[model samples]
Target: MVNGPSTQMAFVEVDCLPTHRDLVVATLCRVPEIISIEVSARGRDLLLTVVTHDWTALSDLVLSRLQIDGILRHRTSLVTDIHLEASDWRLDALNRAQTLEVARIEVHSATVPSTVTPADTALIDLISHDGRIGFAELARLTQRNASTVRRQFTRLTACGIMKFRCEVSQESSRWPISCTWFCRVEPGHVAETVRILRGIPETRGCFSTTGESNFMFIGWARSVTDLLRIEKEVAQSQPTLRFLDSAVAFATPKRIGWFLDQSGCATGEVVVPTFSTPVSKKH
Candidate 1:
């Protein structure tokens, strides 16, 4: 859930010992730094989204910490800049008026303290488990006044430490295939290339990174054939963009904080991210 330039994020592809696959996954689930864990269909065993305070912290996690017994080998791609985040993904479900109404409330609570407190920890943990929990229930669980819980909830969302999103099973949605592209864009054309990709409706998130590929994006498609069309669209728009690799996710066991079932529905099993509680907007 961390953002801004001070925060470090990377996608790591891990190849685990086949005999210990299940054990490896269970162990990774407990690592606070590991966020999104994808069980790929092929080419890799697991793909992880890991976050840390800086490059040094990231190196420590990747080089030292992630070298678990079952993990045979791994590749890390450090995200240098984020062009489009999941929060920026628009489903276009809300009309002008309804969107404006929601914006008004968000604007009112736009500013919050940069540092987290003990009270914030309790509130964050509760909400991370169940986003639909009522303010009264949160107050009861956190042992804070109802009004105080409400204020803290607003502040958490406003400061970008936590985000609320509504997701449906990709199998049921119009775009059923989940695609990720690892690409490299000429340094001078990075911004324009990002602009082009962001305008494309299928894009879920896009980032500029350091590794074999300098840019990468997650996109959705109606069918396997459509992936070629997306590639053509990007190639046509930015001739300098080169595709180094691509993947189609078979199953995502964990995303953000929720553990999903095969159908991509939340299973009520939550792993409240350890770093999410005290994310500092400033270093």
Candidate 2:
């Protein structure tokens, strides 16, 4: 059985020159530790979620690789937890097969109890490789019968251990820009802030993390004007929420562990790190 990742995860926010954007993305994508990269529509900034055994080493490596004249600045935050606000897993079987009209939202929060089982690991690995993999194929990969696989799948979903998502291309969907908003709210206001952000129609994912800016969300827009309108609406509605920073994804090479093709379908490459704690031995 494959042991899940036992180390900390990091979400690094980066800003660089638009001209060197491709070069920076190409370099970072080659690093195995980087699980996914979301580039802004203007190609001036990026958000990288990296899984590694050592946070310090990973941060240093990122700085070294991206430190250039075009590189304006960067910051790395240790992700304490990840919360899935919405995705295909939250939908019924029929909805899971339908195309997504918006971006999926995942929030990073403080550490929580580890929820990993052999079956959960198997399901995640298989689905990460193929988001739309059917039950029969999943059974074949996990060495279980169809019935057992289906039962485990249901259990995993119920327990919130993992979820599957079907992403559509921005061009096809007519939402050409994807933006992630990092907001710092009063300690007691975090939950309310998240709720407000999630309620927005543009919100694809909403997350709470460990840092000054504890709330984050990904929202979609058709253009810069539309994005500004969304932000304006949020500001007027939620005056208590302080906006920290935002990054627009021009290209997403990988999202939620699936290596994406130009059209945003899974490309058979899964970089998702498993999280499982070792079982204690009895005396």
Candidate 3:
């Protein structure tokens, strides 16, 4: 749920030698760049969500750090545009009245900024691990006054550099199947194509990426059979969109900062992303 300003994210497919799959998964888990790891069923062995400070850093991660033993091959797709995020989606728990009431609330307080300071970095580092950490505790950890910490936290959120999400075990949530679709459409119809995908109820996230498949999206399904229905719906919605490939996540070892169990429940462990250098303030 935590993100940084100027962060670059990519979806990397890794094919591990069958015998070394467990070992490889364990090794990749320790890398901070590898924010999320999923065992895929249809296309690749592992699907990874990696974030870096910039494109150069991302290239270094894919070319050097990710070149570990037991990984037979890997492919990286850089995200160019994000149409939707998981945090933006909500479950169908609320009724009409409750949903309308919640929607009426204003969440944004401060104006978004394009840069962050050292103070922002400290706050982000702490909240990235525990989003619920209080202002007092954050002050104690960061060695700043509580009031200042609160102000800085507000600024960070306003800048869109700090965001929070509550993640639950997908299995427990009943939508156990996680699928990622790779598709492509004419450049002229990108906006229309994304609009059609967003109308699908199962869609969790949609993004434009740099690859043979320009569009990628995620969907959570009640069952494998439901995937067919969703795919058909997508095809019917946008005839020009071509499906390059699709991968179903059989297991997710990590998601964002939380380490998930086999049932997709958090194990109370977190891996906060490490920024190699503090963000410089723009003049």
Residue 164 alpha-carbon offset, candidate 1, angstroms: 1.9
TM-score per prediction, in order, is: 0.88, 0.69, 0.92
The worst-scoring run of ten residues by lDDT in candidate 1 lies at 274-283
Model 1 residue runs over 4 Å out of place are 2-6, 53-57, 95-97, 108-113, 277-283
How many angstroms is residue 20 displaced in model 2 relative to the true structure, after the best TM-score fit? 6.6
lDDT (Cα, 0-100) at 13 in candidate 3:
93
Q: List residue ranges in candidate 2 displaced over 4 A.
A: 1-9, 15-24, 30-33, 41-44, 51-73, 79-120, 261-269, 275-283
* Backbone clashes in model 3: 0
For candidate 2, the 10 contiguous residues with the lowest summed lDDT are: 84-93
lDDT values for all models: 0.80, 0.65, 0.83
lDDT of 3 by residue, 1-283 (tens): 4455567889999999999999999898888888889999968999998888777889899999988889999999999888898887777778999988976762563554655667777777778877789999999998889999987877665556666676767999868899999998788988887788778878899999998998899999999999999999988888988999999998999888578899888888878876333476679
Model 1 lDDT tens row, 214-254? 89999989999999999999999999899988878888878
RMSD (Cα, Å) of model 1: 3.4
Clashes of each: 0, 10, 0
